[model samples]
Target: MTPDEPRSRLADLGVGPGAFTRGRHNAITDVSGVLVGHSTVHTDRLHTGVTAIVPAELGAERRWLPAGLAVGNGYGKLVGATQLQELGAVETPVLLTSTLSVYRVADALLGHMLEQPGYERTTTLNPVVGETNDGFLSDIRSRPLGDAHVSEALTAAAGGRVAEGSVGAGAGTVALGFKGGIGTSSREVPVGDGRYTIGALVQSNFSGTLSIAGVPMPADELVSAPPAETVGNSCMIVVATDAPLDARQLTRCARRAIFALRGVGSDFSQGSGDYAIAFSVGNGMPPADATLSPLLHATLDAVEEALINSILMATTQVHADGNRAHAIPLAAVHSRLAAAGVI
Candidate 1:
């Protein structure tokens, strides 16, 4: 889209992102010190790539950040998970990529981290890598993804507006029976001492009845156009905040955020491996009861909107092999939401 042209995002279409104040960039990167980057492989040979989230600057002294993992379903590969769970900290950048490339990305991440200024004697480093299958529209067996793509993503990661939809790990992903990909949003909530921010990034590839603000799509249309078995299979959600919290608290926050998926009509199919990972970067005390409630609510709003953004921002793409994924029609969604008085 051109600078003078309008983009098709939920807010632009009058869809709500919940009852919270948005961050400056209205993205996950709005959280302090968080940076995002993507490397999209769109050639005929490869329709996949990587999206990287750098919690802190690569050369920053504080390499580790407090984090937690919430497994909505345990049916996919997530490297560094074991150590992350055991230590409740993440020392390296988080990488999101296609399912089969998780290993290669992890290997690349390790190499990248080791080369950092202070990792000279580091014998072991945990690289957080999450993924979802994108083999339906793209040729997965090609294995075209590699360290170079990882390097590119990591190299460009920066704190600002994150590029969304049909990019990086979400390049070939399908969601809610439509084109789904990388999406992000952020919100600011009031805490006891002050305010904290909650940001979300989603890789949506799961399918179910399509609903927006409790208005389900015409049941007949969904039945007639059921989700292609090869797509709409899983999702990866990442939550970031500048608040001070340990892994356990973040895990709880992640669990609470999953409800947003249900609000958007996710059936959590057997093949849909829904996972949410949360982390905090600041040094303040944990949020109080009142503050946590609003934070959780705002997170749900951000997650729901982010997931929708993934679909809205993507464009319908046809693969060389003839497979195709259609983008959700934004004009149609706006009309429906308006009729239901949800906008």
Candidate 2:
């Protein structure tokens, strides 16, 4: 496909819908008041970039939102984890970038937040930044990102269709042996006289056996075998919702998001850093415990599709070091899924 060609998503392949209905954009931005943007650095040697997720409601007022985090594995440099866990809330927009560039991006994010109208007297801020290693396809040690990129992403944030695959923090990422990048999906659930939306965005860069709708891809059918070096990378999952969930409920939702990895065949290896952060933008009393089942189910479905979309929407990438990550063969995948009666 050409650079400008829109990549296909899970639904585009005729996959069946899950229990809940999907949101308009089928992205995290489907959750009202949430915006997403990316700043990509795609040079010959640098394939890394930064992505910003802004809860628009937190604008200049910088109001805190209920949030929770869950970790499947602990092999990453996720900034602001302890503080987020301790406070059970997030006060600034979340950022994602290359592994080594986490601290730099966090600093830039802090600067961006402090400059907001209401933070003039702010003394402390926990800038949540997440990362996955893009070293195989980028010169990661060079740390190519800066404040400009962070500002670009934050300023460009908007609520609409999100660009996925080989962009933003996922630009150089490898996942399930393929060129993994960014992917997103959202679902809407109905409660008592109201409805809520749960959306998931994933930076997929972990090792796994590729699976679609519970059907595993045969080894002989793969266009290319996963490289030995692609075995122990990480994945960052961000879940957003309009549900009036507290930190505890959001944490449960985040755990479900991480669990969705199993559906996509993630091994959750010792060296892999698998993490999920969930936040809510809605303000009101949360639904009862019984009503949360559908939300949790929606989280699982959205995250699973998001992971698959990360692989499907990505384009092949090559690094300055002569290493390469190939995009999954779409035709072969379609045939495999069709033959398995999955589509």
Candidate 3:
């Protein structure tokens, strides 16, 4: 937000938007200890790839954490979620890719892990994978995701900057009649009795409907053209926190992401596959202990912040396919808000 914007143009915070509380960078990388990597593929016939999210304790091997998943729509494929849920732990990186390419990424992930000097020799590994449909701009039939791309994503995973819009798996994604791709945001809540941070990242390829805090606004009122149909859009949300929480508590945090999603006008359409995964650093909880109240509150604050961040800093991205999906154009959106006396 400190960056200067052209007087004639408004900044794109995410899918459909006007303004919300945003971090200094307004990106998922704003979350402490969260790293993001993108493998973008653009060729004569390819416009999709993968994104890897690493929530490690600065990439240390001994840093174990609790994790959980929530599947809003099961129409899409997700790998390793069962294990993550069963064990309440996520020891590996999470990869997001196009539909029909889950197995390829999973296998590549395994290989990537083994390639590490003491990978399997030290411990068994399990990778988390999530995806959405990209058949519109990509040759989804070709199954373009391969080992090289997956490996690149893993190797490139690092904390700091995260590229959004029309990159990685979002390169071929469409939302709300316009070109929609990746978006991210973060929120900070007082840790308790107060301390710690919670953040969120979203591979938002969901449908476009105009809604402001639950009130529907016709797309035409904002953008010149609205997407044709709102069907088949999907979104993948990932929440990461340094707070200590168990698997069940993490799952609850992941569900909060849907609330912010609805604020941005997502109806969780028929063809949409909305899924969330939440992970937390151990904080002060002992690995052997099964119950801790202080650690539990940390997770609740994280879930709340993570969901809000997913909707804040996402800017609109236009794809090469000639599709332009704009998150409520800032100017029109602000004007509409003022007219409705909501701003």
Instruction: Give per-residue CA lDDT, model 2, range 1-343, as digits (tens).
Output: 1242346888998897689988999999999999999999888888889999899998555468999999999899889999989989998888999999999999999998889887898898889999999988888888889899999999889999999999999999988887889999999998665799999999998886878898785433575554524633899999999999999999999999999998998888889999999999998998888878889999999999999999899987876667777777778778878998888
Model 3 error, position 145 (Å): 1.7
- Give candidate 3's root-mean-square deviation (CA, Å): 5.3
lDDT for position 160 in model 1: 86
Give the runs in model 2 whose Cα sits over 4 Å from its true position.
1-6, 60-62, 218-220, 225-228
Per-residue lDDT tens digits of candidate 3, residues 96-201?
9998787899889877766765454646677788888877666788898979898788778777656666677666666555445666555444444444456666
* Model 2 lDDT at residue 73: 92
For candidate 1, lDDT tens digit of each residue in 156-264? Answer: 8999888898899999888777778999988998867778899999998887766877877532353234444445378899999988877888887888777788877
Worst 10 residues of 2 by lDDT: 223-232
| Candidate number with the higher lDDT (1 or 3) | 1
> Could you give me the TM-score of model 1 versus the true structure?
0.93
Better of 1 and 2 by TM-score: 2
The lDDT of model 3 is 0.63
Candidate 2 vs. true structure, TM-score: 0.96
**Whole-model alpha-carbon lDDT for candidate 2:** 0.88
Each candidate's TM vs. the true structure? Answer: 0.93, 0.96, 0.79
